[model samples]
Target: MSVPESEELCLDVSGGRSGQGPATWGQQAIWDAVSVLGDDAPRYNVSVGFELPAGRPRAAVLEALTRAARLHESLRTRLLPDGAGGLTQVLDAAGRFPVTVRGCEREDTERAGGQLLGELAALPFDCAGQWPLRIGLVEADGLVRYYAMALSHTAADGGGLRRLARDVVMLLDGVSPERLRELFPATQPLDQAAYQHSERGRKRDAASRKYWCAKLSEGPRGLFPPRGERVRDALFPNAVLHSPALLRAVDHVAAVRGVSGSSVLLAAAARQISLLGRAPEQLLQVVVNNRFLPGMSQTITTLAQEGLFHLRTVDEDFGDLVRRVHMSALGAYRYASYDKRLLDRDIEELRGRLPDLADHSCFFNDTREPELFRPPAGDTEVPPLERAAELTTLAWPVEFPPRKNLSFAMDVVDAPGALELAMTADSALIPRQDMESFLRGIEDAVVGDALATGCV
Candidate 1:
């Protein structure tokens, strides 16, 4: 897994200025997680590759990256640890952005390139020591064939990474930063930090605490039995259920029920957990992206927060529970954004009052289509040469980090022509066979709902 010294090129980014600010709430949550995990945790490293069209020059690739580093403050912001146990984001405007140009042998370029991406994906971030962005260029025959960038999640979320890629391509096409700033004005991460400390933000935090306190008061402690030991891994081993039929069924059911696809999917998953785990009540930690707020949609930072969703005392009938799950999911999304540190404190008090609250570690996240994948606005002036070249992101496989006290986590994303559900769980608690059966039950429940609702 070692990269050879001879095949690498390093360049120090120059002419950038420097500034300082506090980390945003989203950044703080990521910082805290990384601090706990230390340097070995790759839980937050996001790596995305772009296939270089044949006509594009290698110089444009490098220039675009350097420009990106200079233009995007989040990529250059470094977290400095305080003696009193806090983190401050230091933005090096003129700091050198490192670009690693790795040349692959012509014969082994394709295979080695894939391996290289996975290796980069597994590398941890040093938030307190260096810039949060790492760029890797794959070269063959003196031309840049493919390029990949790995970013710390503290600076960007899944959506932000995609946006970053789009901007890079736009820059490669010779779009001026002024034009970009006008067309897609980004809300700087620092601004978000300021808002998190504002009086309004404090009020929002209080509202979140009240919502969660009441939500946890009625739920059973947890969905899974006590394992008695905390797992040190950032994520557990998991399996995926990808089905075009399932996706169609979910959409059909949602249409008939006048609900979102996410609601239908959530209902199906909760139903499966109730049947398989034999827990009449299920507590799900649902992840929601808080970018829907004004002036924050284009912000390139981590804005994802978790909201607790409790499915309790449901009647055995599956159809009735779907309505309940949908309503609960709506309520959960409403209270998803909040100060994590404050929310954590409230959770502790709630757990004390309701001891079973300790067992509610299961999570669900429905990542709908990312807006970053959309085509850049056509109205913006751009060169025909850059327009001729097709640019898109390449997906890379990344391992999930282990979760402490997490029995299972279910993630659903909309694939091209299907819905994909990836469930990661602790094998010691929910065995492989049982989880597989749970997946089957989800499909069955979804299909049954679609049929019963006249969606067949």
Candidate 2:
């Protein structure tokens, strides 16, 4: 199967209504993150911020924050809205204040984070459920040290967050981003909300409901074990090894084979499941994202259309598998355009997108957050990772409830091309050692690739 060139898309986003914070973190975090209004909350909410070292000047960081305030209106004014669904964004009348400050210890990250978290508790954010998401920074080394930034998932997705970091670097060097107003499409969340409330949108919503009901005709059935203890972190998926070497090799092969990242991952997953002793006829479910639709990107709104990708752990070679996965992805991408409304109208008792229930764990690869997505602009230089570590770094982990049966949260680092992939699952289903072993296999696979041929 051949993949076509990607076309830029837009999404409709609304300004958002001001709302109070929730009482607890458990489900509230997910609810808030998903419902965030200023832009797309559900799809773009997860983020990671970086702290970097300064060579001679320390003021650039502060300058960058100031610039951010000036550029984005939501950062300036909080939110207020009419009793109806419409929203009003208020930029703080007082000149935009720089939110960054230097601290002496590693705990500075915690200090800043606590303050912001407190703000989320008290203030009403534009979107409901999404509280303040931020990271703290501290300069322990004193002389020309590094700092970091943590933003909430609601404001931007990993890609948007990285873009903002590049902007900061540019400001330090006296550069500004290309005005986005020109390239940006007109599909704001506000437009989507208006459409969502319309008679047409209502009809669409109803059709979508019927489509889901028909799609999922059977009761729930999965092989996952139940949780007995109060889990501290998120889900714990069973050991599933995606060899780094195999991953690399597949990519190398794809360059010569002319396929995509999704093709390689899917093919590999199908093989892995088969290797795990699943019968060839067994059904395996996969999650597919629909971000490439017309007017999906840039709209601060959740625009993903979820669809299940069913595969079998049957007889197939790696190349054949890659081709199959590519074809499946393209098919799903096209099929998602109708929304649930059309499905209901066309088919009876069709199933809606749900978690993996076919005795198989989900394999989702959203590499959008990787450094490759956002190029270095405005002559901004990203400080070395080593420099960042020299400074104090605090990771106040945000525990967003598990949405799928098991999730793979792929977060991108601020650096040009790095990614952090996190897989969460129910603890009862997988133990820590098992998880470690699975990772070890991937490491081995990556190492194996390097040994066979000088390839990273």
Candidate 3:
């Protein structure tokens, strides 16, 4: 990958009205961390790349991007600390979204483009200094071959990224600008914040608070104990355990137990953690896509939040355990959307009632997609996806706020044929061997149960 001389074009987009407002639940959660870590925490920054169809008009491509920036208010938004030591989202109604046109030789475009996409994704966002989005166009042989966009996680989430891709394709398909707005409109973060503060939103928050207080009243148990030598430099190692048989087993068990695949997987994970930690109870936070609200499904904004689920049981049947985990996840998902600051206050209040209440930061995130990305079929001559012009997501290690012990995250990616269960652990905590055992145990919990139930 090489970087040659590049020309910059700042395209000013219009439509959004300059305004200031409170952040959304997801954004607020990220802000809470940014307040302490600043630019060190890059987990909230997201990037995506798309291969443009070959022979497309360059002017049309540029126009589509300009319209996209205007369509999504979040792309034009930036956050600043309020006078009272909090964060406020400022929407730049008229913002100049720069698109750097970089030309790579046809032969080197593939390698250079991939490297550029990664570097763009890794670029840190200056929360207080700039807008939450970045756009780039990779061209070769006088034709644009690739387009990349990086947005702060505060602006959009995994689901929101897909929505952005869909909208851009629609624009390129020659949809009327006005009709496109009506079809795929941006839901400003301010509107989401207003809803969060509404009476209905308040009611839901109260319910969520009550549920969490009850769950954490007994205090958080240490799920993974640090042992042996620690890495001199703070680093985390992630390992993925993939198996087709285990995937089938998970589906079979879920079918037999009348639960979703997620429920079964969660149950298996909880069971494995309990056995590995050698504790009756295990504390694990589940990342939920808090998009249950009306219009939020298509509304591109930060909507991912953490849901706490504690699994404490001994000698329970796998099926019954799955049912219990399923019910717990239901509550967690329902209460996932809430102001992080208020939620922290509630946790502190609970401390008085339950003296043993402690915090456990280890979590589980299921980022599986039902189906992979399918390019939009259109009349335009879309370029073939080659080594140079490919579409994919980049995952990098995330840095958390200071004063961190061992933080583990179990991420699951579902594919058409198998399930990829990845266990990521801070090197200071469990050794490589233990992490491997925990992952294998999770696989066994599902496959073993399926075989026992004759469902496999």
Candidate 4:
């Protein structure tokens, strides 16, 4: 495959106003869209890619990108205010723009990712005219091509990425766009946001808040150096270096122990913290989505909340802690609708919190994508994907480097499961090995967290 000196990639934004300007979509609608995602809105991006037949045409690729953007009502959206206080995405009377394609260095895709992630970290976003996602076509020999797609986390999620890939394939094959639809569109994000505020939701919310309010007060326990450091530089893990046996152990333990892969992950993190913090009082914050609003299962918005666990790292059973962590996750998932911004009193305010909280650990579960969304192998036939051009997933930025004092962000991607741990810390205060040891502890906890608890 000849890497092109210049590549033509497209960026098409579905949710903003144009020529007729705000006439197409109102500000109220746009705000509502953003409001629904809460803090998760800014971090959202859906990406997927596929290979075309031996002789797939480049023109076909272009058409696929254009057609799919035109087809989805979501792509034609604008984040506007709902007038009362929240935000909603107003669909343009006409929902899409002809795809916008540009030519840049093959390296452009890489730089774009770094910059986009930084933007997500540095700014609180507004969706008007925002290009939340982008598409790239890379040459895969004369007749074959590959697609990479990237998006703003505010708009679509990993599941949405799967839909985008499937749709692009359908459109390229000449499927009519109108009849095209998501497998579970009713579970769209907007509907979920409404459920969060519903009466039934309130009951769930009360219980979750009480649990975390107590958990958040406890100190962190991990392999964190006294000066603190970021998770990425510390872990130095890009690919899985551990044995398959270890990864298999992670999965098997999660299942036998009645936990999600993420719960297992947090447990691992706790174990590492216990060793690193050196004291039993160390703390970390986990981010959980409140997206279970009844019907909105497939929506791409971020409905999230935080959970802080006071880990019994020194002498407790791993099984018990895993159960406690699992239960805490359930509670948080149920009530994440109540963003701290809306807490009943003064201390509950997000603004009132520390300016430095960004330095703490915030765990997110993208779920191992394929495992989270699919059924048993024979459950359903996944059709061959289509798109006019190759897609690219590197458009979004990576992240902003952390200041002194460290933090970690965990992401699960396509490769065999491995942690994409990111961190920020005072370089002068902590060395890199401290971070690696902390990450190893997280890995070790999956097997021995119970041992740590027993010692306590």
* Model 1 ranges with Cα > 4 A deviation: 1-7, 10-18, 105-110, 225-237, 247-258, 313-324, 350-358, 368-402, 413-418, 447-456
Those runs of model 2 whose alpha carbons end farther than 4 Å from true positions after fitting are: 1-47, 51-63, 73-100, 105-147, 177-188, 191-247, 277-291, 295-306, 312-315, 334-421, 426-456
lDDT of 3 by residue, 1-456 (tens): 336776788877778577878777778777776556655656557777767746356688888878877777778888887777567888887867657677887766666566667766777777678877777777888887777788777778887887787788788888765897686555578788888789988897888877777778764556666676765665576677765556567767888888878888888887776776667676677988776667676777888888877766744688889988888788678877777788889888777777676446678888753543533334534332221112222233354322364467788776434567777777566666777777777776787788788852
The sequence of per-residue lDDT tens digits that candidate 1 reaches over residues 333-421 is: 77887878778888887778766653567888877643345223335343222221122122213445666767788888666545667
Using all chains and alpha carbons, the TM-scores for the candidates as numbered come to 0.82, 0.56, 0.83, 0.62
TM-score between candidate 3 and the true structure = 0.83
lDDT of 3: 0.72
TM-score of model 4 (CA atoms) = 0.62
By TM-score, is 1 or 3 better? 3
Poorest stretch of ten by lDDT in candidate 1: 387-396
How far residue 214's Cα lies from its native spot in candidate 4, in Å, is 4.5
Task: Give the Cα lDDT of each candidate.
Answer: 0.72, 0.40, 0.72, 0.47
